[model samples]
Target: MSTNKDTMPTALLLGATGAVGKALLKDVLQNGKYAQVVTIGRREATVDEGIPQDKLVQKVVDFENLNAHREAFRGVNDVFCCLGTTRADAGSAENFKRIDQGYVLESAKIIAEENPAPEGEQLSPVHFLYCSSANANKNALFLYPQSKGETEEGIRQTGFQRVSIFRPGFLEIETARSKPRWAEGLALSIFPPVNRFFNLHMSVPVTDVAKAMLTVAQKKENAAKGEEETTLTGSKAAVFSAKIIDELAARPLTQSSDEVLVVRNPYPEPRSFKVKTTAPKQYCVRPNAGRIEPNSKVEVHVILQPFKEEPPADFKCKDKFLVQTAIIKPEYESLSISEMWARVESEEKESIRQQKIKCVFQVPPEQIHHETKSEQSTLDNNNVVVNDVLSETPTATPVPVPLSPVPQRQQQQPAKQDLNDQLVRELNHAQDKITQLQKQLLVKNEQLERDENGFRARSQANGPSRKLPPTVQPQDAVHHHLAALETQRVTEGYPPQVVLIVAALVFVVTYLFF
Candidate 1:
């Protein structure tokens, strides 16, 4: 579908701090399709540096008090809900429900009620986009999946006109916290290679999930405008599986030159392809009908011709085109059915087999340069006003003016002061270290004293018959007595020489400071 560049939609982002939610926030801000993005989280959203704050609105809110902030949901065109948490993070299964199910459902209901589209409109202004888990079932034994399933059901019952739910398996989060779960790490390591064999739902990256959600929302909006049918196939509530999410996340191959477009066949078998354009005169594709070999790509060189000799001032030219590829299988005729019905069924299958890719290119006029210049001028005026305000403000103390360089003597004074400060810091650090060591020494001395006292008491209790052990020689006894005496003396106080050194250092520091 062609995007109306002139019309910029506004979006609201919930759970904007999670891995998937952060990805979505970045994409929404960078896409340029949205004029404003409102992020509601328990705290302010962490946005990347240099991203235009003009387009971002951050609202700190408590999920439990969502009704008080009901106005945040008003007038939003798309609501991307990535709010969820694990049972462990939530502390209990009940709290997990309060967030994953309760918060999500409540927010959806409020958005639907507050941001309803005009009467008779085909689509509501608020398109509820949700992030759900794979294999989520209300009857599941696991608390996490069951909570997600109940949340999905609750969202559907809220009666939103457009609701898209994405069920991705284990997400490979890039920005996860440091504490690692061995099970999750093991699964992430083992899941990718065997994912396709297991229906491609084992694991996916957080960024892909984010991309899929945004892409599906944009496609649904386009479909509502009658631009084209949405690639998503479902009833009012569209559900995208992991495989579909991966496909939606994949970017279509485009040539370096704007005029040329490239299409690749990732499958291991050769496939027939076709290319068609709505404006044949504007674009010509070479080798439009052909077959691509297994694991090979077809480069359809699109030659764009000038639309007019002298284009009008308001001439905005855009074209929509389609590229289709198909793989045929001859063994499907074994099904039990009438020959006529079989033929019709085979034809239907073949028709559906062809994968169609739509591409749009637009050439807008050159009036954007003037608009940028005018915006720059307005910014300059605002800066001037700010500077004027700052100039008018009075200061009690005179501001220090920066001079070219200080005289050599003046520089020497600061250098001495720096040395003095460094010495003071070093002295303090040394004193702290000495104090810590002294405390440890005191603890050890007390322990030694207690042991000696216990030994003496035991000897006294046994009377004169309990003599020193045979192994305890006279020299050993003398060494033990000396060690105890030394320990007692050290514990009493510092030595005289050490005291004198510390006093000398203190005197020098005081003299320097004065």
Candidate 2:
């Protein structure tokens, strides 16, 4: 098979001597998609007879000292790690951990550290495919599963761009091994009939496991390059169960048109999101809606339904996708994705944010030159047609159309309505108090005038013989009482403007109504 050198990917495989690793080696070597396959182990791997070894590179390196052999991981786009051992076979729990967890994690670290981008440039994260056991939990009581779970976690921490952890239940090894596992053999013999009758996925063929890893890796690489959609989901670090692995292996290797769209929430608050594609009949999106926490992201898988006939080379994708997102309130956070979206639609429709992305289909590189020549010919024909049209209308010229700017979502008005309402209430209360104060002042003025009139009459009748006691002016006493009331109202937390307005109102009433 002739492979395109420029488009082919390189793979770095670990544990090539193991059963699953051997099958993986055979698949990658014959797949025609990988340009190079590098296998690193404690000793050189033995290739089967009649299998080509031109693209295969084997490195004998000490797993404990992977730093010394960093070159083996350089320039590799994907890594397949099938390294693991049972505690009984490894002789002790510590040995099992050392081999399964320590070595596997170290290898991942070396791959990440060795494959650095050149200065001032960036590179996509390497896709890592791991073969982990089923029911692996970091808090597992058994050492085997515990080590496997802990190792999976360690690999995640190693910063590989994309990670796929395959958890096969009971692998049916076709090739004979140096040490036979009686329990595994018995389970393998029993699971097929049991699974066939009960519709369970408790076992998988070794070749299928290898095939599943290759399929995922291929899908991931193609999805990155916009050639195919991603088959995996959940997180950047995805886990595949036995059933999923079987399903993935059953998928054909060619003519897949899957794409992965990523939705990220940069806002500090959590967000609810929904995805919809234009061609719902032709395409299906996984996790059409969900909630994303602050500073997190979710991947939406777009799967294209199979076509009956291939489109021509000039096929352009007319499909589009819309991503709808909204900031989630604490109450809506607890709601299901559908319920949350429904609530948002009914309650806060304007808060929903939407982004539309156009779909782009990439043609094969071999057709690029032909497609370019065809495009040039079309452009020439269009220019000739345009010249003819312009000659017919000598004085007319095409006017450039100005595109309207996209309207931005208006900012929510500041939440000062309540505050303004409270201010209005206070102002009304202050005005009523001022009216009451005005009435009291008028009554006092009337009493003071009466007393003054009486004093004047008495003084006149007594012929200036009666000594006037220390006389108090009614106006001065009224002014002092009003000033004291103003000070008291000011001290009671009324704003200066309110106090001033009250005083001005009282003075106006005293001048007019009095």
Q: Please list the residue runs of candidate 2 whose C-alpha ends up more than 4 Å from where it truly belongs after superposition.
A: 1-6, 117-124, 221-514
Name the lDDT value of residue 93 in candidate 1. 81
Residues 150-253, candidate 1: write the lDDT tens digits. Answer: 88768766766666677777777776555677788888778776653432335777777776677656644122331111111111111122111001100111
The sequence of per-residue lDDT tens digits that candidate 2 reaches over residues 1-514 is: 6668878789999999988899999988888788889999998788888888899999999877788888888989889999988888889888889999999998888887887644554533578888888767787898878888888778766765566677666777887678888887788779877755553446767776787677667644123321111111111111122111001101121235454545544336766667777889877878888876754566656676765544433566577766566666888756788888888889876545443445544333345444543211000000000101100000011112232322221121233466788899999999999999999999988998787666556556656454343454556665445334433232668789999999999999999999
Please give the clash total of every predicted structure, in order.
0, 3
**TM-score list, all predictions:** 0.45, 0.45
Compared with the true structure, the alpha-carbon lDDT of candidate 2 equals 0.62
| Candidate models: Cα lDDT each | 0.58, 0.62
Winning candidate number (TM-score) = 2
